[model samples]
Target: MSTFQAPKGTYDLIPPHSATYLAVRDAIAAPVRRAGYGYVETPGFENVELFARGVGESTDIVTKEMYAFETKGGDRLALRPEGTASVLRAALQAGLHKGGNLPVKLWYSGSYYRYERPQKGRYRHFSQVGAEAIGAEDPALDAELVILAHDAYRSLGLRGFRILLNSLGDAKCRPVYRAALQEFLRGLDLDEDTRHRIDVNPLRVLDDKRPAVRSQLADAPLFRDHLCEDCRAYHAQVRELLTAAGIAFEDDPTLVRGLDYYTRTTFEFVHDGLGSQSAVGGGGRYDGLSEMIGGPALPSVGWALGVDRTVLALEAEGITLELPASTDVYAVPLGEEARQVLFAQVTELRRAGVATDLAYGGKGLKNAMKSANRSGARLALVAGERDLAEGLVQLKDLTSGEQRPVALDALVDEVRKALD
Candidate 1:
């Protein structure tokens, strides 16, 4: 074994499993791409204040989980703990808001770093495929994002997930609700840290998962009840649009996301099979986030689906992705002379768009055949000095255990036909 290992709370995706991660990412990004969301990529790290101000200092992600550090130039930077803030910063920096298009749509797939005590479905380094629709406050946009996420999960055969929806009243009423919630929480018996959170961010206190904390929150004021008239109308329209599109969701009055910028619509996608870390994905409208990060007041909505969690969900629900074989054809050379010719043949087959692999190190026919079988290839191209001399190669149908001789010139065409 190598002396060094992957960092704690991190993993290395290898071989067949890595293919599944790619498929999940592509599956999640497909609907957004088709909807005109251009792909955007940002640096893996950004100015620490971007997340501190945009993601909210009170949230655990910023306060406890962020991987922040100082550079040699004395600038504080942080590995992005989440996607939206960095994405929004990029849009603002690029001046996408100045364009005529109301909402600057974008999609991204990459790894994010956090310093959490990792467990199942949570990691220090995780991957997410995210979509952001910036510069719009339309309820239809919110509904569209939710529908896209739902479609992505369904397309991947994830059936046991449910969407939880809520509204955290916007600027007009959130302050009033915050005061009420803080007042209610202060009266309860809470520790100094928990009580301090009520002053810093009262909504996060509601998100507390501790049994002791949750037990006292039963009668706490709900933001949905305190939503302003405009926010109420907006929330109602979002729900109506979702219903009209036949997407099912439950109104979760207590579903406050773990961010400070989210206002109006807030939601989460949960799968029971994931145990304690049930959230597969979630996002909501952040009408004030642009301004929070020192940009123009551009309203935006987006969601990020966890690639690792989605894979786990697939396993929990007993769904296999039915991935295509890694190799469509495996070439086996029986002798030294056949090796040179077969290597050229393998290259030609691959150049012709066939997934062909070659058995190297001069294995005997039996061992090479075993390697071919293990490759999950549907067909094996076998050639010996005798066959090569005859200007032909032996093609074995792995599934059917059938063999035939094909002219060397027709090898590529025959393999393509067999694959098709």
Candidate 2:
């Protein structure tokens, strides 16, 4: 027989460590909730074509990184490698866009999967806090999404992070820019794989992370150069609004998003702390994804922040989150009768919103006290034969090492006040 373990790419968030994870999640998602973005959850996996069409077949996620399997019923599904496609699919299926809400604001937090070479800040399974605003094309919406992500990072006590912004030019102008980039890339000294990218998605060639490839494409034609009057105007307006709102960003000429659906505004959050894997999260506007994935034309924009990467960034910056202790009281019972009565009292204390726990095994007084200490509880409630006979329970303050006898009828009140 062998001991079981969690899957290689997954992890079990346990004990005091899990408290920090939760705190990070809450801090990141608090603003989205406050801004009236209702919570929405989609399936962990969806039909494979949903991502294939929406994320682009040439991208790494749909071609190699996706975890796809066929069900017994002959449906091909894949664990979501990202959040936006699944969210958009759900919104379309539910007819949320058809009801004329104009812009349906939603926020979600959950795990996303990708089959990547595991390393620090890059896991096969990870978590993200994402938000989407569907059915609108206003640059203000783009600004709003960017600001929300900026606020989340700032709220988490993060410093030395830069927000990079770019406009990929919209439908009317992107095709022209693509043709110019393709022509320039074709004349370069490149490999067959890099050349193939020109035919499939020339814009992504600008996103190449390889040193050699980046060096070659440094002089590549700029998308901003070929932007039509309308697109150029829209991009200008988005920049103007961000400036007015005091959101600073750099205009990177070659900033092409990894996804195929993105159009117009694209952004990324980068931290200086992490050495190699520095991108904390990113997203952009996908104006035509709805129509591309068998739904009515819906223009939407959103972003997803990697919770794991953010935590690593926090660690890198020495920002320690002091999570509160798990327990306020530990009930230690000596005899069988005392255990039963103490169990009932523990239930009552919990029902009244107090964090309480109890010793499970029949342990000696010293051992029970040890368990109380290990629980991080500030106080302990002990009920023994002698104390019960006297119609009282012994209360011990673990911090002060002081003990007092409290009447049984007033135990809950006494404990509550002392805790306060």
Candidate 3:
């Protein structure tokens, strides 16, 4: 019989490497938690229309990459490919906008799925740390989210990332810009799909990454050139705030993010170390998304940091986070009586807040010591019938190869002191 394997384009987080993923998630979440962003979690799947209506049906995430399926009851559902739409749906369902506190600040960390060709940084199953400030429209709010993400990466000792910023003009001015961009795009020698995209989301045509398509976009109408006075002013304020906070960013004219709801203030975190799939995280101000998804008017801004990509970025920089050992003390028992006694001591040590583990299956002294060493523990407690008869246990320091005997009753205290 053949053992089952993980599905293609996906992976199971395993071992000491899984620990790094956890540390990355925690590091990204810490700044958001400190900034009053409360934790929120939504289902892994949702009505297919939520993303179609919110993330834009024309985007590849909806039309090409979504893992959409029909359930037994004939309900259309899709595993969440991105976070903002689902998060907004949850906030609307809970009526969070009605509470008068303005933007309901929330943060979440979870695995998001997309049926893409798996590669180094891209995966069919990926994880993201998302934060949203819903129901408010403030440039400071946008800047706050960006600064928090910057601080998160900095706290992780990352120094090779760049922030690319832009403003995709708001409703008041976007329509006029859209018309001009469509006119310019229609004149280009484009393919059928690219031509169709021109009629649907014209701005995205400028985002086409194909060398053939990009060469023709050299003179495409710039969004900023058409920005109305209010949008221009709002964009300016967001830039000013980021500069004031000492967060450096580049103004990329064609940085229209892959979503339909975004309007005004858009930004992305890019790590040069990860070739091709360089975006580590990004989000923008979506002033009309709440109404689009059947909720009251909620102008919001949020971002999702790709845990997988961020981890790759860390590796690209050769950074290793100092992680605490899984086991602080490993107990090795030589006999059945010592096993029972040490088992009880292990429980007590754990209850007393010491990270402890024990050897099992009657392993001999040498083999048990090897197991103890592999537990990533710095200390080991070895007890036998002879040692217990003398009312003591042998404590060995794995690091310095030192050994001493401690009173049986004082095992926990002695371990704690030695660890301290």
Question: lDDT: which candidate is best?
Answer: 3
Which lDDT tens digits does candidate 3 get at residues 330-410? 999999999999999999999999999999999999999999999989899999999999999999999999999999999
Worst 10 residues of 2 by lDDT: 1-10
Candidate 2 lDDT, 293-333, residue by residue in tens: 99888889999998888989999899998777899999999
* Each prediction's whole-model lDDT (CA): 0.93, 0.89, 0.94
- In candidate 2, stretches whose alpha carbon ends up further than 4 angstroms from where it belongs are none
Q: Which runs in model 3 stand beyond 4 Å of their true positions?
A: none
> By TM-score, how accurate is candidate 1?
0.98
User: What is the lDDT for 63 in model 2?
Assistant: 86
Each model's Cα RMSD: 1.1, 1.7, 1.1
The residue pairs found clashing in candidate 1 are none
Which 10 consecutive residues of model 1 have the lowest summed lDDT? Answer: 411-420
